[model samples]
Target: MATRPPSLPTQMKAQFLDAFNTSYALRSVLLPTLTSAHDILIKVDAASYCHTDAVLGAGKMPPNPPSFPHVGCHEFAGTVVSIPPNFSSPSSFKVGDRVGVPGRAFHPCGACFECSSPEGPDADPPGYSVYCPHSKNNGISTDGGFREYAVVDSRQVAPIPEGMSAVDTAVLMCAGVTIYAALKRCGLIPGQRVGIMGCGGGLGHLGVQFAVAMGFKVTGVDNADAPLKLARSVARGATIVDAREQEASEVAVQVGQEDGKKDRGDMGLDAVIILPESQRAFDYGVGLLRNHGKCIVVSFPEQGFHLSSRDLVFRDISVMGSLVGSNKTLREMLEFATKHNVRASVRTLPLSKLNELVVEYHKGEGGKLVIDMALPDEQS
Candidate 1:
């Protein structure tokens, strides 16, 4: 039933955050082992950096900050080295299967209203076990993918398609799924206009492609030249806007005129998906919506939103928040990504340069950065 590689080592190299506002310490730690019937042990091959890692490192995560000595990174892909002998799931995954874990919903409480459905978790529309408050987050609350080996909840892992690499799958685990789920929450049909507020950043660029693939007319809005260039390259037909060059109202008017709508009632986009962590981005995104349009908030800004009563009541604007996504959504996203050839632009560095990668992320690097665990330490 359960199998592992021959001569598996008892110890492995891992990066750990000793405390908030400190650097990640590289340490030799004991390899993680499967402890539950639903546990799957994976030998991690790649782990992608995320803004949440920076937030956690900087001690900005509110309410319950991650405990000390936590392993960073939530987006990772690897080969399954071991599975519980008594694995109790309708689906079957054996050792040696390539898989990716979405760290958002780990160990969801099956007794909750969101998890206890008559037709089961995989029912159409799926269960909202991702929203179960009692669930443990893989990277945030528990040891995660920064290590050579990780034990993930079997119920939350998805099999990687044959042609996809661990690096690409790692990016899709978080950034891809988050953006895809946010787009779905927009509730717009094909041919409708949608605005991606931070279209050039890690999630925004992917959002642009996914929106275009889904048959929506997209406006890629960002402040930097590089991201604008990236957005243009990815979605050729998208309307790329430089937020630094124009005010939110000005950009809104420009998008309206380009869409051939002169009337104020018909102007503006059907929905604006806010993907940046800037308050300005939030404000600007809200300004780009038409009457009765929706504003889907996916990024967490420290200051939060500053919405006026007019925008909510008079304009009939609906605001909603979306987290990473459920297992069903993850499968759909990966399938859609494969079919559409949607992928994240990523740069890879050896695991030894993880601290440097985090520093680069803080410097506002454009695209995703991944830690290639297989790389030799002397390579970089």
Candidate 2:
């Protein structure tokens, strides 16, 4: 049996963006209602801040941008408040269950080649459906988790593993699954060398930990000393390189040579997951790969990258892009994180600070911030 909310509010407070590049304003709005049998209502507990939210709020998401007066947040966790009488959810989900609504917020057709294939040529790549034309991005196409309550698809919500804090689960919903899918698609084997570009970021840190968990010889490359230190602390025996001090290419070459001398005798890094959006980072990641190695681009960069067709053909280096993790991958990632205790370092703020924090995030002055909606009212 699911626990019902004590009282559903008719109107709730939410952060709304009325125009592009404008500050979000806290406004009282009607609570969202579930219109589908499979839909569920959630009272938000915690929501993590994402750079994507900042970018989308600024109305710079390219040709198609989110509609105005939108609520912006994708990574969030909450408790189930209501389930339709005929709604069918996973057996594990019950009313009052702590749940997480992460990156893949849309429902798939379930009949498309990408959705139906399983580990075959046509199988949807891990986390691939988030980009499907039919998919509706929560924060963009619909109202998202920036408010006291949200209406979400049953398939998009996962039960947070027991004993995990909602704050931790909030960050994991996006960063954890994104990196997990990228590494999975890399097809790395134990003892193979792998490098994480931008290892100190919200997503980079998780990439390092997951690679290390998979028994890959991991190298964390980042420009910031603080993130490097944090990465090193989390991933034991992993190599940390400060990209600011030395060229990423040089670091990769040194590690590759040393790794080749080891008993496994691999020549270069098996793959490099580029976690930053800088063109230079992508270039360095390609440089780090050995012949026939792969590069997974997981970050969003506004600028275009220059790739020499000749260089690509001669080197046999494979470059691919990963958006978000799929439902299957999301489940795997959550189990893996719980089993291996992979957690992100986060700073919690009351939802009241969302506006102020948005400003600070735009200025680039914070680590991973999880908004705790449970805090006392402090709206500005």
Candidate 3:
């Protein structure tokens, strides 16, 4: 077991929003108190921002999100400082263990079909504790990991494996597990071909890496040089396409040509994962699939997809919505990441610079911005 700090703070700084479309503010708030028998208080070490944070902060999360005094960031990693006694926890973690709290941060109702299914303990049923009829998103619906210390449900966190840092694991929390779930839903096997739209962004990049690691021939699609370059670096032997230079339909034609089967318009990708929120990306992704191929819908667009009914019926394309991922898949992805040495290309900034970082993030800056909570005195 790791040693606990000699002292714990009563008050901690947190970045939060007072209302929708408001700026994030850093304020000294009382440290969260424990409530549930399985609740654990953690000293946050790292956290990362996501596009969903922007949507949630705008009061846009569907099915009615709660009013403000909302915290930012859903993906975080920290050290366990306190745990409830007699909890009979599922996780084997104790105080001082490094762990991560991801987006699916609530215990699902065990009575649901998804929970009782034979898919094992990690499968997420339709009525997941968070999202849809249940709106239990961590940062969106509750105070998240923008503070120095946070109170988290024990079931919502998992122990960090050996040879992985908190920041590296933090990248996997939301984006990694999400892509892994998307791939799992598609059911692609080795030698299969997959196209990842927005392959340069956080999720897209990780998607390419995971797909390649799983032995899929990957094609990364994105227009930006920053993401495209990063995608190329991560997805060796994977094809990179520019959306600006060609349409989705055009890319489909090109992919068919790869097999010298341009004469056969029926040839297309085995599966395509849409990672960008752009409808065009979704449309392009649909064009890349072969007959009966799966199109995994993983991105969240403000405006929903405008899919073609004719193509859906005739082309025999199937669409699957992959939310975060089952705990089982998460563990698998983390193990894969650890084995393959896959890591999110990240740019670290002090948590104090969160307000500024949010602005820069909107400017389309490079790399994922991780809030490094190491104080000045704590830094080397």
Candidate 4:
């Protein structure tokens, strides 16, 4: 017999938002009854901080953390603790079953509009549904995954592939799917060479793997020595370019080829995926691609940059932006992860440790931090 979910516990420890104007503080979770259909309860096992999380935690929001006093993560994986009323039966999952919910819900009604809309800016992110007026987002107005428990929409739940740990899967809920969806948007072909700029950071690492698994020849690009080594290790046989955008513009001129070759297999790059959150990186990605090649962009920066439409039109080079991927794409990502032993290198921390971790993260000291909500504070 399937095990029944434990009674909804009261007084959960949570990362609190004392005010709508401030960041999260460690506090207790309090709420009304969990028996309603609208009260879908989730025991957050793993919640990964996206770069967006950093900004929100800092209170840089048009409208702060959705509802104040809410958890602060969308890219998360957890077990179903309780289902609300309305349509609770035919349990999509039982208690203790491991599953991962993609970070966003684009669909509002039934089917997602992302599948129907022609791909463009006004179109919702690939995984969003028509109901998700606030598409391309999670934890925006809703309580996120930062707390020990969350009440995510049932429509948003998806399964994490069996045999993959929550730590590795957590990163996939957001970054992995974002890149996966981006590459899909580019419609890359087999044997095509793709360059992944910033190829070892939070999103870049996953991009490299996804490109590699999808049968593209991937070139991992980064400036740092440590991340470069990690990228090289994971993408064995793929080239590691020392070229950063700003650094590359100046330095590539200096590496004057011994054979007097300008292309030098670098400019011969077929496509480019810019994951770095900078305009320079976008420019460099465009430059690295072959004439007529595509540059798939995944990062968002404040300052807008420009490119010669003359260059784009004459060369037929395309610059396309990709947001988080669709639900189906996330499923594929997990299947690929399961098949190829793909895993996110995660440093597990306790939910209570978030205050410290967030500070460390901003200082550039952490790598893919995951909050293990179930870990006892004593063990942590």
Candidate 5:
């Protein structure tokens, strides 16, 4: 049986992007209604600003650019306020349940090859529906959680763990899950050495914590002092490298020394996850990997990766790109985070401060910035 929904307002305040590279306009818009049977209305409690938001705003997301006047922000946490009467599937959520939505993909076309079940006994697992091309991307191509209320696909929502605030959950929805998935893609076992490039930024900070919690020996690489301090605070005994002062090769040697490797030739990390959008940072991360080591790219740079043939063929280094996690991975990550007490270090501000937050984001501020949607809008 579905739980009863509380009384909701017919109109609410929301922020919309009128054009590329323009500030978001706050306006009173009709509260979003359930357009699909699987849709659920949420009273947004918290939403976080992400680097992807900036990319989307800059019109850099090509192939399918976002329609103007689109609601921005893809990472959010809120309470379920309503569910469509004909909601599909066995509803795991009830009205008033705290939930967080992964904003990358929504309402995947179930008939596609990526969504179909494996055919043969040894068939590879079906790809994550989050990668389905037919799916809608919240904040990028569709409305997202930058308002007092939001309409989300029921299939994409995850239950917020007990004792976790909506602000923290909002951060986890994107930055947390993306970094965790990247680490998992590294395929390194416990006690293996892993390096996190840009370890003090939003995704980087969480990456450092998750890697340490997963029992890997972590080395945090960053160019700035603020993020380096953040990385050191969260990484415990892990090595912290300042890329501004040391070259990539020098950083690699430092990591090797810290790993207690006496043979200089054998010194290198098992894997390195690139979390910053800087091409230099990406190159530096690749340089830290040992022969046969994997380099995971999570950040998108305008110029793309500049890898030499030597880094690929001679070093036998493998490069992998990771997207935001699937629903299964999100659930597992939340569980692991809850069990290990891993949380994002966040600074909360009201929705009215979003524009300022975006500016701060471009200036390379450290830690996650989340909007407390429950706070009274100053403009209101």
Candidate 6:
């Protein structure tokens, strides 16, 4: 029998959101040349939709003004199909590597002060995925992880660590590393109490787990009356303190700590990770910290919070902003999350279902919604 010709490879598809044009379209786009820059070209087995991505899709996001028709999703985990022959970085792995690029501080000038900074480039203390002064985000300027394939710098790529799956690793780049880095900045010892102001979203849930794994007791606070069950699942043994004036549970800590003068612990509770998408969560987080306590703000809301200097001054509390964990931290974080077996509660949807999911996300509440490759095809 005659051999059939090899099947023609199809163009990759990406979820593009043109905010200025106000359109949500997922279509095939041209792949960039491999010799351009960077080491690995990844086949995205999993790409996660962060609240930041959703906000940007709706034109409510921040950072630089996105060039029109940007590809979507930054949190990524995938298999590396090719590595340039000239690739020389001593990364954990080379081609055929399964890796995660948690998206923060992955700017491309790399040599500039703001890009390199005192903190390690890519990730602080030496991590992956830095948005350098000259760098651009995936799916933002160039195509991002939303496509079937993404190419990133070896400096921005790290092995997904043993014991974690691609589905889980996708968020590890952004949401997972964000909280992990914040906790590290807090510099709390094992047993210090940490308050999570928004305890029930993608970032918040992971923050609770990471905090618990670091040996700090987490008190996850959320405005939702029905968050304990979900928070308990993530925090696992940590307290779920309702932000509302709900009478405290027998094992819960605060009944109305919001009303009371909740100051930082004497030895200090280390840091406070606030993931609320609202302004009040930040203000409330500041109130809960102890003297010299660190209130690390994780999310960016529509309007910045209105904080009082008096509250900051008298308490001797320090408010620090955290990006994500560094490449080194990403490696350490996988071990940390694995040792603790911290799993994210994810709702998987397809690329075609993205719009529906985003609408749902903006309206009601749910766990992390991961974009899987196996969606019902719409182009057919």
lDDT of each: 0.84, 0.76, 0.78, 0.67, 0.83, 0.68
Q: Compute each candidate's TM-score over C-alphas.
A: 0.94, 0.90, 0.91, 0.83, 0.93, 0.85
Estimate candidate 5's alpha-carbon lDDT, on a 0 to 1 scale.
0.83
Task: List per-candidate RMSD values in Å.
Answer: 2.3, 3.5, 3.4, 4.8, 3.0, 5.1
lDDT of 1 by residue, 132-201 (tens): 6788888888878998999888778889998999999999999999999899989899999999988988
Query: Candidate 4, residue 87: CA error in Å?
Result: 2.3
lDDT of 4: 0.67
lDDT tens digits, residues 1-380, model 2?
33235477788888888888887788898877767676788888998888788768766665488887888888899988887767763453557888888756466565554554545332344533544566676777677778888877777777888888888888888888888888888888898888898887788888787888899999878776677777777776788888778785577567766865442223457899988778888887777777788888887767657776754797788888877776667777888899888888777667778877676655543247778886676643
lDDT for each residue of candidate 6 in 244-328, tens digit (9 for 90 to 100): 7543222122422432434324432446787876776776676666567688887777777777787578767777777666667
How good is model 3 by TM-score?
A: 0.91
Which candidate would rank higher by TM-score, 2 or 4? Answer: 2
Of the candidates numbered 4 and 5, which has the greater TM-score value? Answer: 5
User: Which 10 residues in a row give candidate 5 its minimum summed lDDT?
Assistant: 119-128
Off by over 4 Å in 1: 1-6, 117-128
Point out the worst 10-residue segment of candidate 3 by lDDT: 126-135
| Candidate 6, superposed: residue stretches over 4 Å from native | 1-10, 20-23, 105-107, 114-117, 120-131, 225-227, 246-270, 375-380
Q: Candidate 4: TM-score?
A: 0.83
Q: By how many angstroms RMSD does model 3 differ from the true structure?
A: 3.4
Compared with the true structure, what per-residue lDDT tens digits does model 4 show for residues 286-370?
Answer: 7666567788877666554677796589778888887776555667778877897767767777888887667666654324778
Best by TM-score: 1
Full ranking by TM-score = 1, 5, 3, 2, 6, 4
Candidate 3 on 1-380: residue-level lDDT in tens? 21223477778999878888878888898788776665788999999888787788777776567567878788889998976655563454688999878866554564555444535345544434333333355676678888899877776677888989888888788988888888877787898889898988888888888888889989889988888888888876788898888877777777788766644446779899988888778888888887788899986676788889977898888888888876667778889999987889887777778877688678664357788787452332
List, in order, the clash count of every candidate structure: 0, 4, 0, 11, 0, 19
